[model samples]
Target: MPVPPLPNAFLIRPIAHRALHDGNRTRAENGRLAVEAAIARGYGIEIDVQPSADGDAMVFHDYDLGRVTTATGAIRQRSADALANVSYRTGEVGIPTLAQICDQIAGRVPLLIEIKDQDGMMGSDIGTLGSSVAKVLRDYEGPLAVMSFNPHAVAEMRDLLPDVPRGLTTSDFPKKDWLLLSDARRAELASLDKVEAVGASFISHKITALDHPPVLALKERGIPVLCWTVKSAAQEIKARKVAQNITFEGYLPA
Candidate 1:
């Protein structure tokens, strides 16, 4: 497949998700090794960042560190230095900070950061998601973009720090028919035109319901489509079957 040129493209077409995490890498999901893999493989890397309860910026995905780290409590409860004590099981991966990620990866790859909001999740104590993101990325030096499922957070990012690139993530992961968007809501976000005004330079959509009508329509307009959660060879095949490229765990095959 021919890799389309991304206008103002900083890096290559393919992006590494949560950094490169094959064996010999750390046991953590979002870590320096994963970002290193993306850079070593000559692609971009995507990650999630949110604030701790004390208002320091950190690089983490879950509302809590249950899955990826040895930590048991909500990450918000932990400080940046404290979170560093939590390591990967098999490999020693101290939880990294946003500043650490940016400082270490300077100009290496595009840092796609998702600012986690506490809109609906229970026990989520992420205080002021947008401002926290703004405070951290203020000094980052490299290709970077911000994205979120919450459009309001995206809007907040725009208002707080207007220069950063942003994108939207959706699971249009299910079949379109199964989706329950109303006519007006669908017309606005489900279409490509409205997506332009959403401050999204590119968008990440899940792969379960690949080649969906609306997603394809977005691609036809020159907007880059990034497929996600591609974990295995089979999932990679399915995601690649529909979109130009993808971000995945384990490895970047192409």
Candidate 2:
């Protein structure tokens, strides 16, 4: 199937919020900074979702809480209420639920939600995160879409939230703390070999891997290729040459 068109000309990924907010050294994935970026810059925002211990879909990035919060341990170990008390390293914002984020944005701009499910660690219910987010989005009248590096999660969202768009997040499998998967597993995730089976409507690829054959092939087939984390004007220039859109952070793109 051909990929669907993006709701916006470009997306402002949450990671860029820190740079846009006077170079705040704290995390940028979720909370007020991201909402500010979206509302102030008039760019669509990308958010990552993870389920809390009580199964509420939370707007967060890492599976573990140590990086962003003063608390430690996997995020799934805490209920939404518990996570709410946990402050970010900045000490101003606590972990916000997906509902809170939606309320904050209030359909002001498009939302690109990236579901962060890995190997079913969050829950046995394959659709837990998608279903949770769907419930919150049920009455929302904004342009939004669900995406995931895990294709299974994406498919679940497609089934439960048929009206919303879906995409697959891909990368060159860079070795990072969040990417604990082995090279073989990373390759499988990045290859897009099972995209047809997953039924992804579009792709959010790593900026450096936009030229990979699978990505190029998808672009040729009219799948909208959106690249991520373009940190500078120079990188944005390069990525825009090949990608249909960009999910950028760190600096404003020209």
Q: Indicate the residue-level lDDT of 114 in model 2.
A: 88
By lDDT, who's the top model here?
A: 2
What would the per-residue lDDT of candidate 2 be over residues 1-254, giving only the tens digit for each residue?
43444565344333232223333355445777756765787777777888899999988888899876788999988999998898877665678899998888888777788888656532234646778988998888777877887778877776777767788888767668335677777777767986677677788888887889889998898777888877888888899887877776777754
Estimate the TM-score of every prediction: 0.80, 0.86
Best by TM-score: 2
Overall local distance difference test of candidate 2? 0.74
Against the true structure, candidate 2 reaches a TM-score of 0.86
Give one digit per residue, the lDDT tens place, for model 1 in 1-254: 12223335433456667677664335455787766767777777778886776777788788877776666889988887787888765466577888788887897767778787666421124358678778878877767788776566766666676777776776542236425545554455444443555566667787774566777877777677777878777777777766667777775566
Count clashing residue pairs per candidate. 3, 0
Give the TM-score (vs. native) of candidate 1: 0.80
Global lDDT of each candidate: 0.68, 0.74
